[model samples]
Target: MKQFGAKIQSFFNSRLGFFVLAIALFWGKTYWAYQTKFNLGVAGSMQDFLLALNPIPTTLLLFGIALYMNGRKSYITMLIIDAITTTWLFANILYYREFSDFLTFTLIKGSGAVSNNLSKGILGILNPTDFLVFADVILLILLLSFKVIRMDIRPIKKRFAIGVSLLAALLFGANLSMAYSDRSGLLTRTFDNNYIVKYLGLNAYTVVDGVKTAKNSAVKANAKASDINSVLSYLNKNRTTPSVTYSGVAKGKNVFVIHLESLQQFIIDFKWDGQEVTPNLNKLYHDQNTLSFDNFYNQVGQGKTADAEMMLENSLFGLPEGSAMVTDGTSNTFQAVPAILDEQGYTTAAFHGDVPSFWNRDNTYKSWGYDYYFSKEYFSSGKNYDVGYGLKDKIFLKDSAKYIEQLPQPFYAKLITVTNHYPYTLDKANTSIKQTDTGDDTVDGYVQTAKYLDQAIGELMTWLKTSGLDKNSMLVLYGDHYGISGNHKKAVAKLLGEKTFNDFDNAQFQKVPFMIHMPGLKGGINHTYGGEIDVMPTLLNLLGVKNTGTVQFGSDLLAPNRNQTVAFRNGDFVTPTYTKVGSRYYMTQTGKEIEKLTAAQKEAVNQATNRVTTELSLSDKVITGDLLRFYKPSWFKPVDKKDYSYKLSNGLKQLKEAQEKKKTSVLMKNDGKSLADEYKTDAPELKTSEAESASSSESAAADESSSSSSRSSSSSAAK
Candidate 1:
């Protein structure tokens, strides 16, 4: 036993042995993360084998670089390489825990905005097993420091080191060949990030992402004004006219968009434990003044919430690989909803409980021509008030009422909620619903957060009505994306009482609630098949805003003869007759896979597939090329991003100035009085003292109303 131990130690002390050890450690950590930490959906033995084998080439290539050096430097380089890769792996683990997706180059580049208030969340996401990601690094450092693995100072021929790198390249080629055989169009058609990581490992996935990002940047730089011509032609051909019945229905009305984070449509009236999960949303969805769509889907890519927002604002699809908001938002010109409304004499503002940099909204909102932005810096915060991604939904809505009241009348306001985001966690005091018995913490906690969001929405509705804002406002509430990912299929199946779940079910699970509520407006459930891309057009049509000559990819959903094909960010699409999940086709009504397609079904699928491909390609061209910079609409003026400032003091000053000028605002219309006291919430974190203070302030304002009016009159006269 002693002789064998000595032999092992001697081999590890050799140069080649050290290189092999580094590869093995990196390979082991990556596979471990794949199996346990990430939900890559490794199904068959082929995928399992690929997952194990995929790491070898990348590991060899990385550690092989160290072989070029001689002596202790080689050993140190190998260790440093190992440490860096391990750090990246650990970072992805933390990111995947929240986003249910892998990190992209775009996300990393934009990390500065998201890093604020991230430490507390990171601590919560950490698992004891996560330490294993760095276990090999620590072990290796200790071994080298203790001289257990002595460095070999032998000089190797330069040819030998070059051969090692060449061999790595050859192995990577073979790996790619095998991956293509298993999953056709793996690189060309990257429908999901998990596919890349699953087949080529994390290192290769990063390479692919980096290459794609570079190509996109190059494409944007070399793009021409004529590049928008093809896109304009496509839009002109596919554009649908607005419905005469619904057009001008909400003209000149204030627009209030409520972004419901991670709230899926399945929970609209879903009963769990014999209780309604979203009672308030269900009621509002069924209200006579609400136009709700049951067939609405979210077409987000890696960008998720930001993608949905992009679609809602510009009627465009997000990039296939990363968030356009993060990558192109600052530089790209957009004919967004805010700017479109701003041209029509409407004040545009966005209220988010998160930091301005999150999703790059700080720069993106300015690019979109928002006159005011109320971010986390503008909101009051405490331990109880903040949770998950940002401020609690109830607290966010409750605090936003003050700003909402100060916004000019007929304003375009967007309030983005963040409590129901992924890794949905809520304090027991805030939860009013029972958790599900699915045994998946993520799925179980989803209902509680969703319920809390519903309560917040209910409170906002009550306050809007009490302040008479509801009388002249169009309230649009929409779920941003899916709460539970396809990874939790079994838990979702159990929750839905389904006997079995498959790809068809997973595709169907993408549905999210979209409702537009306006008092005395003709409203009912519209079964038009559409996605987030259609939101801007639909709303603009209803508001009597003409989108003629605009470069929008989506048609008005209320149009009588509008095509009802909904294209996902991925190449997959859903139509009224057919649903495509990957290469397979399924009947939309029956959810049965078509083993042998009929002649009619084949044609339908082919046409829909072609359209989806063409639309996605054109949209990608528009974004990656920043084509909007050239295609200036006659009715629109491009936003000068420098004109906007989201600072709290600046926004407050603007509001104050507007009030002094007697510009119409909710508060100004109410005789220079705030309606903050009208807002009511059952959130446990809201202290009674706070409520009393608000009431006291309202009372004091009432007492000084005459003097305040005189002072306002004097100020207006002076101005």
Candidate 2:
């Protein structure tokens, strides 16, 4: 016993022990992302404990580099410098995820939802102290493990300290070169101020400014007249609060929101086995009021899908303009859609197939005015996971509907589906898995998920009818974004059965799927080039609910005079507008009034870009666990809570109300409000989600090859 104690003490005294401990501490964080197929509730288990026993492989892989370091005359000093730098990076991302700190003052100018807004939000909230503590723990453990010890550095000469500083500077420059990082002009300024100018000999000022100027010039190149008109009009209309509000007759009607993962329109265009991948969707194209918009696009620049949905639902845009879901922690969303419903005495709830906090969604949903959040944990299912992370969509839908249908008189629900989540492969032979993927079973899993989605819809509809609420539901479904970025070119070619080729990913990247299922309403089709942001305004317009949330970034799709236009940014460059006609552009920024575009285009591009960037930046804040104050006073729907502070004094009103309410509804005739003769006086025939009235889906027998034939048949049958 005495010998063991001595051994342990000796280990702690050795320098080698502390090095191992530090490495282990940093690596421990890998377990936070506990997702793997065929595993249930086994997070941070064997892997966390066992990884250290077999560090041989990692050590061998880096042995060459370490050996090279040994050849240097200043190997010990260089090692210390490199170690500290690595530790810094680890602490920045792992401990804080940069949730509270903004990087550059200049880049913060734009109110965009993308291009750079999200990136800024991400870098802002980092906690250096947490990581440093973790580092300290590591050092403490290393000190206990007596391996080959290098000791006594504080007593070294002053010249040695300077040499170490120079080495650190060299390593930092190398890191900058190898990191492949990009920054916005404003953020770049901050980076220069903090790291580049002080540490690197280069004038970070010139470099950052050059980047910003270059970006501005590149954007100027991607402009159009319609774009210019839209932006300038927005600016003219007041950059602050909106002057106009929408009102309609959607009272007493049940609202249903379904979020389809990775849904896109290009599914209808992309060929699959010699035909369209989404033949059913395409065939339904002309069945409704198709707008065939000349221009409409998604403004989210990065973190694509999350950015897409956050901006749409919150009436906010994405980063560069603001922050992203995981980076920004200062978003203001409590004044969005749910708040509108809450004013009308409607019950509000949100659902997701994954952990509620994965993207900081748990906190953000409340700001949108939801009364309850249903994440995987709350669902509390006993079924085993065939694939990791959450329940299958079919099950979630069937189950969630049961819970939602029981809400008070009126309700607003956000259902975010996840069966179609990425990592596209699943463990074989897992009977519990609804959307299982085997190595050779790609199509089967996806197809099964589609069928599962249909089943989920069917189940939800059944609940509505059985619950005696069939005629009072209004439903809307939209894609979060395209499925995870993969080998799109290869997938497209495979779907089309085309010859193998290099470089060609079709417009399928921009497409997914969307639908609005408004029960008790007349059935028709809508074809407007609308993004998610337009959904709320469009809904409010239909419901006779006034719009309190309008920021020149989006307009009510039903508004007749509204221009359906959108812009996208690709790697620092603004992409041309993506319209129903397809992607095309021929514009310049100098205000030249060519028949195609003019100076107005420049203004529009900047405004739109700025809006998106701001949204992105803000979204990050929500995802990182901070709530910004929302002051939109225009939200006066009947169901909304006039004061959110009832919780501070009342202690837990929202939670109590949620538990007490059985169900709720909002509608025109039900609320005794008069229906508007037209949602938009100018667009008397405007299509809306209220037109979605059916229950069961007919997606089953639909096939790509028979798309055209089916459409023609359906048309003839109807005629």
Candidate 3:
């Protein structure tokens, strides 16, 4: 036993042994992360074997560089490399916990905008097991410090070190070849980041993403005005004329886009333990005055909510790699909804209870031509009022009424809620509904937060009615993205009462709630298959705006001949008749896999597949090449980002000045009285001094209302 122990120590003290140890530790840690942290969907023995073996080539390639150095330096260099790589792994782990996707260079470059908002979220999603990623680094450092693994100062031969690196290269080549064999067009036709990481390892995946990003940048640099011709031709060919019945139905009305954070379609009418998960939303969805879509999926990429926003506003798909809003938002030209509405003599503003920099909205909203932005600084925020992503939903919606009322009439406003975001955590006092017993905290708490959001929405709706804004405004409410990701399939399966969950189920799970509500409008649940990309065109049609000759990928949903194919970001697509997930096709009606497709089915799938590919590719080209810079429509005016400023004082002053001079605001029209008093909530956080202050403010406003009315009457008489 003594002799064996001495031999083991001696071997570890050698240069060769140390290199091998580092490779083994890195490979093991990466494999563990793959199996535990990521939902790579590794099925079959071949995939399992490839996933385990894929880490080796990259590990060898990275650690092999240390072989060229002399003993102690080589050991230190290998440890440093290990620490860096482990940190990268740890970052992805944290990112994947929320996004369910890998990191890209674009996201890294744009991190500065969102980093401040992520601190609390990062701490919330962290697991004790995540620390194990650094276990190898800690072990190596401790061993070196204790002198348990003595350093050999001998220099390795140059030829031998070169040979080691060459061996790593050869192994990587083999790995790539095998990966290609298993999955054809693995790199060129890459669909999901998961496939890249699953087949080529995370390190290799990062390299691929970096390469693609660089390629995209190069493409943009070389792009010309004529490059938009093809995109224009495609859109024109597929453009669907707006329905006469629905077009101009809500024209000249105020537009209020309510962005529901992380609310999925399943929760719309979902019942848990005899309790409706979203009773308020369900009521609105089924209301005769609301047009709801039952088959609206959120097609977001790694950018998630930001991606959804990009699609919703621009009628453009997000980049397949990262969030275009973060990566290209500052520089890219957009004919976004806000800009369009602004051109139509409407004041455009956005309200959010989070930091201006979160999702890079502060910069992106400007590019979108929003005249004013009311962000976290505009709201009352503190520990009690703020939760996961920003201010509690109830508080955010209640406070937003002040600003919403201040906006000029016939305005376009987007209110982004944040309390129902991921890591769905709500204090016990705020949680009025029962949570699901899914044995997963994320899944269980998701219900609670979603219910809270619904309640908040209900309060906001009531305020809108009492304030009389509902009569003139058209409300567009949509779930931003999926709240419970596929990572919690077990809990989801339990909650859904499914014996088993499959990829088809996951594809179907991406459906989100989309509704348009207005008074005395033709409305019902419309079974149109659409996505966020369709929002801009659909809304524009209803506003009596013609999208002809514009470069939009989506057609109006109200168009009788509108294409029903809903393309997901990852190359998968769903339609009314068929749903394709990865390499498999399933019948949309039955959710059964189609192993033996008939000739008609095959043709249908092929046509849909081509359309999906074309749309995604064209959208990518438009964004990556900034094609909008070249394609200016006669009716559309390019937005000068300089015209926008989201500073709290400046925004409030501008709104106030506009109201005083023009009396164009809803509040000004209502006799210079604020309608914030009409908003009520059962929020526990507001049940104290905050509530009292609100009451006092309401009373003060009431007491001064008669005087304000007299002043208004005198001004009107003078005019």
Candidate 4:
């Protein structure tokens, strides 16, 4: 006891002993974290963990161990290593242009997280993971004091071994916890969000989160099971409600909606040199009465590209925050555009290049009412050439053609091409853009992929014309989101054209292109901006078919009433977030908002956000495929459509804000430095073009948009 007390006393008294212990534990914990998230999907060991700790600590811990063994000379080597790690961690948080823990709002609040440690001078010895070492140093300082310090410093065989064991245990614990934490975030929040409000405290959190999760899960299952009863009951009561027949196609008229991967709209502009990149699309714009929706933006968070589909086709919003569609376990719920077409006697099908299971698109399509689906695994294996990720665009198109031949008359087909995905390499790998942009894969790959996609589109268009379907069918295409193409500016510049392709939606991402080609309605254009969510209903209205608005949360752009805002979710969240509110027919993204919006404008924003978010309540249903055979018109209700824009109230509201911002900027600039109020703007010029388009559509929807009396539709067509 006396010796143990003396050792404890010595640890508190000796800086050298305390420092060594901190170093040992720091490196140990770090190595454990690194190993946890490495490639392995499992979180059993330290190394198998996903999202492991930063690597700085491990390096420093080794240095400390060396110092303890050798002598003061260790400081020279240790300092060099420490300097590098510190700087890197500091910079990581600072720039956060790339993802870093410090940059994330979710991670910023954790205790023991490090900051302000990066330095340029320490570049030589520090490995990327070294900074984790410094964090341990700090953590030790925070947790241990005098007597406790000695507890960490003991005999080399005993104390050091114990510390190592302790580290492994803690590390394993943290890794498991981390994985659990993510699952818990989604499971717990979902439980709380779903039942906490309705069932009172019965849905309270249970032990180890298992109780609440179990009960909550059961509730969800029960709730979903109940949807059928409710829907069936509703159907019986509403059986008297007759469905309109869908024979609207005038001869060979067909519409094709193609969703591109991460193609933002801001990729074109004369100023951006985008004119050449999308020459064909641009050509279509001017030659055909093409309406380019300039302020069109996607607000999908997480599941970035898929979210575009969620919004565009199903009028569904982004997923919940922190949960991924890939990991959400529970599939999303909702009806798809195919259901309506199936009722109308059109073949409803879906096509994709990746494993249908990746995003659960396979199961999801069934729920969305797709009568047929072609996923990567089940795609015709005999088809040949450039088998990059899963299948090439050319092959995708070729495969699509095969399906088209077998498709029923007046079919509604959705083809999602995936050749544009990362690594951007093709059989004919083009590297011209790489020379100019240096380190930008976004540019290099985008140019190559965009060109490839363009060629494919041209082929598809040509085939349609040759097949004699051109005059009878409509074609629409768009991108999911902008690429994280290693080089943003150079890649965007190359693909969109340095001049015109410069801006798509806004500087946040390249604006996605939404192309609409209708049979018989050829050369007719509406420049009004919209997103994926609006596509389904808009098509129904354009085809002049009675749209079954079951679970729809978007305005029908083609209806022409043009009074409701088009809403989108940023594709970065698991839950719906980052709402984009454009005037029902407006295309302006940038302007001075000096004053706050009036209550009316606020209400509009609320309406748009809520209308989109309400879909989250049933995302699980969409993914589960239970609702494929059933849907409701009221579920997809559009906002109140009326010509309220340009009213004195809205104009005055905007005018007021502009004046306020102008005044504030002047006030702040009085000092030496200039201060300007900044807000995100896609552009202010697209509004006029949008208006021209909207005016035209206004004539089309003058009657239908207002006649919101629920008209029913069913997947089953009784012969």
- Highest TM-score: give the candidate number: 1
What is the lDDT, from 0 to 100, of the residue 534 in candidate 2?
Answer: 62
| Tens-digit lDDT track of model 2 for 336-367 | 67766777777777777665544545434544
Question: Which scores greater on lDDT, model 2 or model 3?
Answer: 3
Weakest ten-residue segment in model 2 by summed lDDT: 677-686
The superposed Cα distance between candidate 1 and the true structure at residue 50, in angstroms, equals: 29
Ranking by lDDT: 1, 3, 4, 2
Query: Once superposed on the true structure, which residue ranges of model 1 sit more than 4 Å away at CA?
Result: 1-217, 688-719
Clashing pairs in 1: none
Task: Encode model 4's per-residue lDDT on 1-719: one tens digit a residue.
Answer: 99999987686445456455545564465445333311112334432333334222233333444344433343334445544544543443332211111122111221112222223223532357534536664655454543354332223444654474456456545544654544444333331121111111111111223443354345445554446554345334322211123224332345577876655554443222233544556665554545445545455655666566667666656555422333222233445566556555565667776544445353345445565566554354442333444566655676566445444456677888876676566544322222224256545555556656655666676666555556666777777766553236554545444443222223335346776655334454455545566666666765656554354555565444343344334321111112242322111343223146568756655665564444444443443333533444543422111211122233335334533444322222233232111111121122344576799899768656545322322223331
Task: Point out the higher-scoring one by TM-score: 1 or 4.
Answer: 1
RMSD, every candidate, angstroms: 12.6, 17.2, 13.4, 25.2
Worst 10 residues of 3 by lDDT: 111-120
Clashing pairs in 3: none
Ranking 2 against 4 by TM-score, winner = 2
Q: Please state the error at residue 468 of candidate 3 in Å.
A: 0.4
Return whichever of 1 and 3 wins on TM-score: 1
Ranking by TM-score: 1, 3, 2, 4
Which of the two candidates, 1 or 2, achieves a greater lDDT against the reference? 1
Q: Write the per-residue lDDT of candidate 3 for residues 498-588, one digit (tens) a residue.
A: 9878888999999999999999988998998999999998999999988788888887888897889999988899998999998999999
